[model samples]
Target: MSSKVIHAIYTDDDLLMQAVKQTREANYHIEEVYTPFPVHGLDKAMGLAPTRLAITSFLYGLVGLSVAISMMNFIMIQDWPQDIGGKPSFSFLENLPAFVPIMFELTVFFAAHLMVITFYMRSKLWPFKQAENPDVRTTDDHFLMEVSVGKHNVKDMSKFLSDTGALEVNLINK
Candidate 1:
């Protein structure tokens, strides 16, 4: 069965937040919200679950640290032991202090690069992807809230959204 949706456009972020809260309180399902910039606390306002990107970043950093340690051990100790400034070329642990910079740099590099890749994959933001925003204005200076109209009265929803400071309300079928 085809479903109907209500698109509420708000000019202000504050008003959008208030509308989202009111909509949630009134038992409406918010499908999504598109804004020009990231709206602080908008996820919480929409009752979304917290993200787990930090955990992934930590894992990526650990991988990078492991690679750095192994690479440094192979190159410095096993492959060709170096005698810089007459330092002892004995153990990996003994020369770990010198590899601290490489370890730190690799950790940060992997964490940053992998986190960005993970974010892009999670958000389905691949290169050359078409924009999925319903309203072009939302890309510039508007905030759009998409409310699913499952068993909800469209007229009442439109009126309620307008009352909640929506500048415009439009119905879409899908």
Candidate 2:
């Protein structure tokens, strides 16, 4: 469904940041902000919750570690029973030195790959996905902030945004 939103454009990141804070203080609902580069503290200013990707990365690493241990135990201790070097004992701990490299590699591999996959999925940007950016200038040197206009006067919001250092404010329905 389409909704009415206000697109506030700013030439500088500092101006955009200040506009966001003022908009929030005035109890305006911000839809989104688009910028050419990452803005430090923007998420916090936008009141976004802390990300949980670190927890997922740790869990993925644990999974990789478990798989590595299980595979090494079955291969060298149970399935094939390799006798490389003088250590012919059928124990995983005894043959752990030989499997350390594999364990470390797998742990890092799983964490990196799964974290990337999780990021892409959570962002709703799967393969060949396209996002509808409201303003083209935002991809260059400009920053764009979208604010919802539900139950609020569009003209007043536009004026308020313009007064808060917005270079331009346009009403868009999307």
Candidates in order, TM-scores: namely 0.96, 0.95
lDDT of each residue in 94-147, candidate 1, tens digit only: 887889999999999999999999999999999999989899999899999999
Off by over 4 Å in 1: none
Compose the digit string of candidate 2's lDDT tens values, residues 1-174.
788999999999988888889999999999899999999999989888999999999999999999898988887788888666777948888778889999999999999999999998999987877867877888899999999999999999999999998889899887
lDDT of each: 0.95, 0.91
| Span of 10 residues, lowest total lDDT, candidate 1 | 88-97
* Candidate 2 stretches greater than 4 Å from native: none
TM-score for candidate 1, please give it.
0.96
Global fold similarity of model 2 (TM-score): 0.95
By lDDT, the best candidate is 1
